[model samples]
Target chain A: MNDDVTIATAQQLIEFLGTFAFAISGIRHAAAKHFDWFGGYVCGIAVAIGGGTIRDVMLGATPFWMTNPIYIICTALALCMVILCSKRMERLQNAWFVFDTLGLALFTIAGIQKSLDYGQPFWVAIIMGCITGSAGGVIRDILLNNEPVILRKEIYAMASVAGGFVYWGLSELDVAIQLTALLSFVITCAIRFLAVRYHVSLPQLKTDDEINRVDNG
Target chain B: MNDDVTIATAQQLIEFLGTFAFAISGIRHAAAKHFDWFGGYVCGIAVAIGGGTIRDVMLGATPFWMTNPIYIICTALALCMVILCSKRMERLQNAWFVFDTLGLALFTIAGIQKSLDYGQPFWVAIIMGCITGSAGGVIRDILLNNEPVILRKEIYAMASVAGGFVYWGLSELDVAIQLTALLSFVITCAIRFLAVRYHVSLPQLKTDDEINRVDNG
Candidate 1:
């Protein structure tokens, strides 16, 4: 019983960290866009909970943030951090990137586990994982009026997808849940780190003219 | 019972027309952006169902489109119409505008009613109504890499909110549901029409610099 309680506490801690990291990323972007404080706070909350909300809605479950006020508090704290140390935070770009990657990894695993618990098929769970890991940034970009970087050239969603596949494989091989989650998280972070370091990106989709030319030919 | 069936049928018809119009708007925007056929279809689906999906999730209900394939078929038909008659459809811009306005009116009423049915307060319902009427367009703009026009200069969402107020007032006075819906729809459409005709718009939100100056002073 104590072991279960400890595990649950650890999971909650990871969730809080991930939410804070995502919220900070959103507030920084909002600051860059010259949004007011309220706008910054809204963007921060959206980024921190956006992915989980989408995942939960798709899985027909209550959104995790709605059940607890902790996520909101985390976002508020993130906003305060950004407001108080904007210059210092900007200088800690590398630190933020690491935190963001960690958040992505943790959210992906949580999304997969939740979907599976809700009896979704593995494929659907995998998609949910990717959505949980990446959709928040998409929402933030949309709000900031920027094209979603993940939809364009980032290796972001792909890394989440890869991590999901790894999770599925490990679960199939009867791996312990904690070990599987840890391995999946590490793999997701590794892929994101390597992709960014190596400047790897997916090919862009074909434009209308290209599709039309092919059709005519 | 016969009258009730007729009313239900009429409501379903309005929903189909709204879905079709919203899908067409999204597809046309995608085409203008040079997105390929698949991209256009995705945008169409997103715009057609996005708002309702958000509303349903917030209200803790299953998304409406999940239970009915008709919305998908409507979007498909819309895509076909766009593909076959792009030039002719452009010539019918005024007709499309009318259809789009009609859609906005219908969706706002529907959203308000759904929220009320789910036991939400009047204010929450009004917000849901505005979201239903305007959010799909915002999603489409984001997908097309444009700033959401509704956020910039359109009096679109305000019209929906106004209609929701009318609905709430009439409902509180014990008006028939059908009459309430009709009045709300008409009010929404009229506001949209008059606003567009007279160039009405809400003021833009204050930027970071403006807020900072105010704080300092």
Candidate 2:
């Protein structure tokens, strides 16, 4: 029981760090938009907490934030760090990207695990994982008055779904929990990083032909 | 069955109009934040669809907006209006408020009805109604870099909850569907209007003392 509790705590810590990194991304964007410190802080917190809140609400759980202040504190610390080290952080785009991808992988696995634990089917869990992985950034974009990066121009959610299938397959094979986590994480991060590298994405629905049709008609 | 089809068509129209109004609200906020027309359009569409998408996903249904293009067209129209009539809209606060509130009421009832149709309990239906009623605005606020008005000062969610209870009572008593709809609509709008008039709200959590402890210690 103690071992189980410790594992859970470690999982939560990884989640918090990911949430903080996610929040920092939003804060940086808000700062670029000339938002005040308060706005940056709020945006950061929203980006960190929004996805999980949506997932929890959908799953009929009290909001994850309501149960723990760690996420909140992580966001605050992220906010403070971003504000204090704005210039240095701005020069570390590659580092931030790596951190973001790692967070994305972790969040995807966490989402898939939670959905499976809830007794949802494999497909539902995969979709839920994608939603959990990408939603915070979606919320951030909407808040920042931009089109969601996920919806517009990224292979973001695709990576999450791909990772989710890997997770399901491994778990079904009765893989050890640590192995399952590592495999899912590697799959998600690799797919996301490669997609970013190759500029891979789903075709946008509004092709020039479609736009011309609407325009001409 | 003919009557049912007509009702369904009417419901579809209601959904479309609500989507338009809700999207316009998001567009207006985005415009105020100095987003370009495309950004405003996307934000509008997100705000319009976000709540319903959440409701649909939670119920394991296909997201209605993604299945239809009318919502996209409506959001585009809203964007055009905001861009072309920015000055005029700035003077139409009353009109915007009325439209926004009407959309809220309609969406609330629609959410309730849909959840009941899906065979959920009354409490769950009521919560769904509130989520549908308030979540778009919350998303808008998050995008606008503010704590949600509903969470901060609006008695917004309470009205939906009250209307939902009224819906439950009417359904239990075998009231005419139209009458029940009208009742929920009027009660929700009236309560919301009164609350806004009186600046009513739930007490906010006073986290200052807790934060002070964290800071000082």
Candidate 3:
């Protein structure tokens, strides 16, 4: 219902960077699936905005991206970047992983903070964080005809869940807003990094053999 | 924003039948994918109400299913039906096809009627009709890790678009709401029947073919 939504320059920059990083992941994934530039752009935009849009819908608020053209521009930029670096980016590891992790960590914090601002419960905030961190990848996988990583045994979403718990714990201990947020973000990033480096993943609900049997039967 | 979203008995019956059919389609598809029962139920509920939720979000309206408890119950009933005949239902083409087509026809009419009620343009109404009829199936396919059939070549969604045109035309000629809706529904159903019987399908965009090629390459 508000006519204008104003934010500080620093916050705007952070959001842009997060969106850019998320869009890059989407664009690259779409390209790997052999999608055209337009399809890649669509996937990039969807990955960049999908979770926030879902959260907005649940909150009964007009989606934030609808009013701001920045997200669209950022996604287009991501498509350009992917196209230009298609071969080189394919070889680089640290940069892609770092950007993706940054996006995840920032978006997880954003989701948790927004939920709290909306007066939602801790549990709701946790779920929101998970959705923000992984929903885009889920959507991308869907478009590519693959099982979503989150629906399997990925620890990516769990990192967000843990971040939410961190935020709540800090709040319970009367932590300052800036510091609490920083701690949560750090925790999310650290957990994600450790999981990837250590090859840690959650156990599947059913064994592969059992699943294959059901599928065949 | 209304306190009560009550409907006439006849309208309620139609909506329930449509939900039942869509949910059956969703559950059956999930079963074939070997998803767990919980996953199947989730897919069922999604297909039963996914299109309406998307339409409502676009219109900035609170999702209808979120308000009424009836939809959730109807989907549960559908799940029960599928579980009871999961074995036989897998081989029964007539039942699945009948339910899916009926749901598509009814949902297309609902989408157009709602869009017109919201005072959207004719083109917008047509797109809404297509979204309402086909978006659920798209989501179902996504969950099952398959490319959406509508995205490839199905006239299924085009049938809904044609129905929207028919509805608009009838309204311009001062047709009664009931008659225009009924006529649109019939035309949509007939077009779907012809398309399927004649093995008609649209050509894939070059984007898809090129993408597929790149993927295989």
Candidate 4:
């Protein structure tokens, strides 16, 4: 019971930090887009919470955020930080990206572990991990009036999938949970960083011909 | 075999019309938000297809749009209509709302029936109906830089839930499929209209301090 309680507490703290990171990333994007402060703050919160909300609904559970106020409080704090530090933040884009990637890695492992706890199959857990980690950012991009960066260009979702698979493989091998989580986070972040550094991208669907035909018509 | 084919054909037509209606609504919202034509069209198409995509993903089935080209074609047509008829379309707001609501009803039943076909229980099917009906609009609203109107004010999701229950109730009574569909559609629309007309709203959750303290802060 004590171990379980400690794990749960750690999970809560991780989720809060992950939410704060996501909110900060979203606020930075909104700042670049010149959105009003209200818009920026709301978008930041949405980016932080949207994926997990969708995941919960899909799992037929009440949204985790609705049950706990910590996510909201953390998002508010993120907003305050953004408002207070916008000038410094504008020069720290590289640092922000690193923070964002770390947040993604942490969230992906959280998702994988949660799905495993729910007794889902490995593939399902991995997919859920991807959803939990990346869907919020996809929603954030869409809300920011852009095609999802993941679909257009990036190793975003792929990173989550890789991390999920790593977690699954570790579990199958009966690895220690802490070791599995740590390794999964490292692998996910590495893949994301490598993809960015190398401009690695999934092939965009071959829609050029279709676009041409439609345009001509 | 022939009868099955005919049923499938009819279902396909309904699905196409529903998709077109949903996409058009999104495009219109994008336009109203002052997005460029391409952006509007893209937003509209995404809104139209997004709910069904989520449903499929959760059900572990191929996404509906990817399974067939009809959805794509319908979105294309919707986009063309919006572009070509932008001026005249301004006068069709009410007409568009009606069609959008019709599409919502159709999609809700589509989702519920599909879930039932997959042998999910009534509660799950009802929830799926709401997700199919409203999630697209929620997505579109968020992307257009707004809190989801449905969540904020409209009795939108409630209408979907009502229609879902209607479907379940009718099915329990061994009602004819067409009649049940019609009843579900009508009931949902009526509820939605009443909600809009009377400004019906759920009580917003507030902190106790907010309730007791005047916003003199």
Candidate 5:
């Protein structure tokens, strides 16, 4: 009589999968920065939950991770995986990047869905999607003492933006929820992968000279 | 009998004052980084609200700035102040530094007060105090592409922690709320000023060698 149990378990599994991938990406960066074990685990958890936390705060909802222990467990597992495979992971340069991109795609879709469920407008949903996909890395980069590459380098947030538009458009066309989510994820990953692979990037703003001149006046 | 109106206005004024100072500091740093007007304004808002946002999220409360428009107005006004006096502010270094220190002190007191209001423990209140004092600068530095100086420099967070302990201790002694807040402010600023005056600083972590050795083994 009820599919709720089955759907809830499936959702939990995907959330855990995404959290683990994000945590691995964070732990790798923390290791690169030579953070102690506890520090590394903290970074892992931060990267795993940062985006969703931001979204939840904006939506006036309790953070998703605080309601469940799965994210924390997944983060610990990710830390262990990284510690055990540090030497080998160092050789597999693309591994964390792939996982990071996949995590971004999944989180973006989930973020947009959550925002929609909150009855937020489409623009807010898109922005929330971008935040979901990219804010984890932004926070991680901050923790690692580096400027977030998203703000300057990668074609990152744009992919999430593009995916948000497609997901919304699909829904407007009466697409089913599962199919719409799948399409959005595929679009996000495809855009991200293609852009990174082809060296596509946004133009860097150059305002030094202009700002200087204005100030001098 | 509804002096709620008068007290609310006074609280709003102080909140705006602190927000303005924080946004000014953030705008100054963004200006040094040569960010465009829009970029600089974004950075300023981020720094102004970042600390309290983190505190509110952890407390499961709505972000303080979101419920009112005053904080946003304060940030915009701060941006305008920086723009109008970019050259003059550069000359009045001591003035801006004083404002920043005052901002830190006030935010620390306010943060601890908020946490206590939420019925959080003393330790959590103390940590939240440090975060409210320092996390804005951390976020600002990250956005500007640098390691947060608070992690290794001066007595920034320590001062907040000390103030938190003092405030909690005084409260335990049944000190009045107003007096406790004022004393905490003075203590935080005194520690920060004394430390800066004497060149006190925490040592940088150097764990790369140990971590590398462990990995090699």
Candidate 6:
């Protein structure tokens, strides 16, 4: 019982930190676009909870944010942080990267566990994990009117997928759930850090002319 | 019983036509981008069912398309139509406008009714109606890497909101459900048609410099 309580508390803490970090990321982007406070708050809330909301909706569960006001509060706090510390925040790119990766790792694990609890198969759970980690950023980019970075560059979602596979493999080998989550988080963060450090990215899709020719042929 | 059967048939037919029109719109846009056929199909499917899927997910219901493969089949048929009649389809702009308006109207009504059936308040239902009518296009634009036209150019979603209010008022006056739906649909389409014909639109958001000043102050 004590161990269960500890694990649950740890999970909750991770979720809270993840929410704050995601919100900060969104607000910082909105600041770059010079969106008004309301717009920034909307973006912050979206990037903080959008993925988990999508995951819950797809899994036929009530959206996690709708049930708790904390996420909104967290976003508001993030917006304030951006407004008050704009210069300092700009100088803290490394810290921002760490927080974003942390958020990504936690969200992916949370998604996988939720899917399993809902009786989804491993494949679906893995997809959900990637969605949870990445869809929020996609939504943020959409709102900011940018081509989604996930589709155009980076190995971000791939890292989430990798963590999901780690979770699946470890579970199959009868690992404890808490240990599995910890390892998955570590693996996800490690992959993202390494990929960014090495400037690794997926190949771009075929050019328009090439795609058109193929289609015509 | 006969009337009920007829209403059900009409609804289903509207859904089918709406799906087809929306998918065509998406695929045509994708083709312009010179996306591969598979990419076109993905875009088609996203615009065809994306709104309803969002509504269902928010309402904590299973996404409508998962249970019905007909929507996918409809999108496929739409892609084939686009491939075969590409030039003719471009010239049929008036016909496309009609079908798209019909879709917007029907989808708004359907969204309002579904939300009400799920025991949501009239206000929430109205918002859902607008979302259902307009969000698919937003998603399509995002995927195509354009700024959302709805946000920058048109009075599309507002028409849906207006229809939702009409539905609420007529229903409160004890109008029959079928008549309420029909009137709501007509109102939405009329507003949309008149707005486009008259070049009506909402103003753009504040400029970046203005927004930044507001934030700083």
User: TM-score for each prediction?
Assistant: 0.59, 0.56, 0.59, 0.55, 0.59, 0.60
Residue-by-residue lDDT tens digits, candidate 1, A1-217:
9988997898777778788889988887777766656456657877898999888877777677756678878988988788776655656888878888989999999899999999999999999999998999999988889878888899998999999999999999999988899899999999999999999999888999999999999
Report the C-alpha displacement of residue B38, candidate 6, in angstroms.
2.5
Q: lDDT for model 4, on a 0 to 1 scale? A: 0.77
Instruction: Give candidate 3's error at residue A143 in angstroms.
Output: 6.0
lDDT of 5 by residue, A65-179 (tens): 8998888988998899888877887776686667677788888998898888987767678767877877887788888877666665578788888999999999999999888
Q: What is residue A133's positional error in candidate 6, in angstroms?
A: 9.7
With a 3 Å backbone cut-off (N, CA, C), the pairs that clash in candidate 5 are none
Please give the DockQ score of every candidate, comma-separated.
Answer: 0.11, 0.06, 0.12, 0.06, 0.15, 0.12
Instruction: List, residue by residue over B1-217, the lDDT tens digit for candidate 2.
Output: 9988987887676667677778888886765555545446546866887788788888876666535567778888887776665565657777667777777888899899889889999899999998888887887776556567778777878888899999989989999998898799889989988888887778878798988998999
The candidates, ranked best first by DockQ, are: 5, 6, 3, 1, 2, 4
Better of 1 and 6 by TM-score: 6
Q: Write the per-residue lDDT of candidate 5 for residues B1-217, one digit (tens) a residue.
A: 4666875676556566667878988777776666555456657877888898899888988677656667767888887777765665666777667767777888898899889899999899999988888898888887998667788666788888899999989999999887788789889889888898899887766699988998999
Q: How is the predicted docking of candidate 1 categorized under the CAPRI scheme?
A: incorrect
lDDT of 2 by residue, A33-88 (tens): 89998888888877787877777666656777899888788888998898788789
Q: Per-residue lDDT for A138-200 in model 3, tens only?
A: 787777667665555457877887888999899999998878877998899899899889988
- State the lDDT of candidate 3 residue by residue for B123-189, as single tens digits: 8988988888889888888887877878888888888888889998998999988789889988988
TM-score of chain A of 6: 0.92
Q: Give the clash count for model 1.
A: 0
TM-score of 4: 0.55
The digit string of per-residue lDDT tens for model 6 on A59-129 reads 98877765567887788788777776666565677887888898999999989999999999999999999
lDDT of each: 0.85, 0.78, 0.78, 0.77, 0.80, 0.86
Ranking by lDDT: 6, 1, 5, 3, 2, 4
Q: Which stretches of candidate 4 lie over 4 Å from their true place?
A: A1-17, A208-217, B1-217
